[model samples]
Target: MKSVILSSVLPLATVITAVVGIAGAASAAEPDKQFFQSAEGKWIGPGEIVAGKYKGTKFNCSFTGSTPDGKVGMSLDGGCRVGMFTQQMSAKIERKGREGYKGSFMGGATGSGLDIIGGNVVDARKVVFTINRNQLRGVMQARIPDDNSMTVTIAVRVDDQLVPVIGMSLKRVDAVEVGSIAPN
Candidate 1:
């Protein structure tokens, strides 16, 4: 009886292990995966006012470090003029999502505590975010096809239409490789 019992238990354990392994692999390959696995890095670019009333001016922007909780944070620094006045400002980007993200910005010349809403499109080699209504959009596309460098683009609305405002090229300074360790 002991021998027979041992034989049955061993086969059951093998079947269980195989099932678990298959489930783990399936989860890892699932589509519609949110949050990027390669977005943890530093990105710098220049922004321009291409639309609306302010159509010409350059601003510097940087995205540094991604939160462990799946949020990308960034900062913007630059100056521009609006109708006989020059101003300098700083802004921060908090989070990005399918519908959009929420963040706040401030400036020394006119507007302070301004809110930003945008949505991001992320793939293996590119990330793009669009802020509607404000007519502003940001894009980060790979430069060397498979390398770590990327080209960034910013577009804004002018006269109720969308137009490219600024463009910059950036390189990824760091990234974290992610993988599944267990079955979901």
Candidate 2:
């Protein structure tokens, strides 16, 4: 029963993890400490399955992102909801990655989840990762327009071209101390 649940939710977990992890791990000579720090904290977002067998299925996610004390990547732990179904998702990525570098994770079963085959930092605000699992391959791109928002896109290789599969828009969840007990 647990295996059944995991198998069913694996795809979604891969999508979310790839997007969040690759956003901070893709390298351009060195890891950007500022960029990694900026990605830490809470995030909430909505995502849609733009194409594939699950086309039109939409989900919302909330995550807490954290950077290792001085490592070169990010880790995210969170859950996503599709109607009443919820799945727990998490990813950990760390590397002094180079172009064509297989930004590998030390955890997880050898062939279970997606592997980051390669990645590149497009600019100060965007990074793209090549993701693969056996013959199935794809690209996940993360673009941060500001410290508070992020947009992620995932596309799969289809014959000769990449086809969009998932898209998500996420925003930082700022802590608000709106109410405090008065000391009388």
The top-ranked prediction according to TM-score is 2
TM-scores, each model vs. reference? 0.43, 0.75
List, residue by residue over 49-136, the lDDT tens digit for candidate 2. 7776677878898877766654566677777777999876666665554434344322333535566666765655676777665566
lDDT by residue (tens digit), candidate 1, 1-184 = 2222112211111111111111111243221122233333444444444443444544444444233333344444333333454444444444443344344444211232234454333444444443322222332222223334455444444466545544444444444432421111
Top candidate when judged by lDDT against the true structure: 2
Instruction: Write down the worst ten-residue block by lDDT for model 1.
Output: 15-24
- Candidate 1 stretches with Cα past 4 Å from truth are 1-35, 44-63, 70-99, 105-114, 132-147, 174-184
What overall lDDT goes with each candidate model? 0.34, 0.60
> Where does candidate 2 have its weakest 10-residue lDDT segment?
175-184
Clashing pairs in 1: 51-157, 51-158, 52-157, 52-158, 100-118
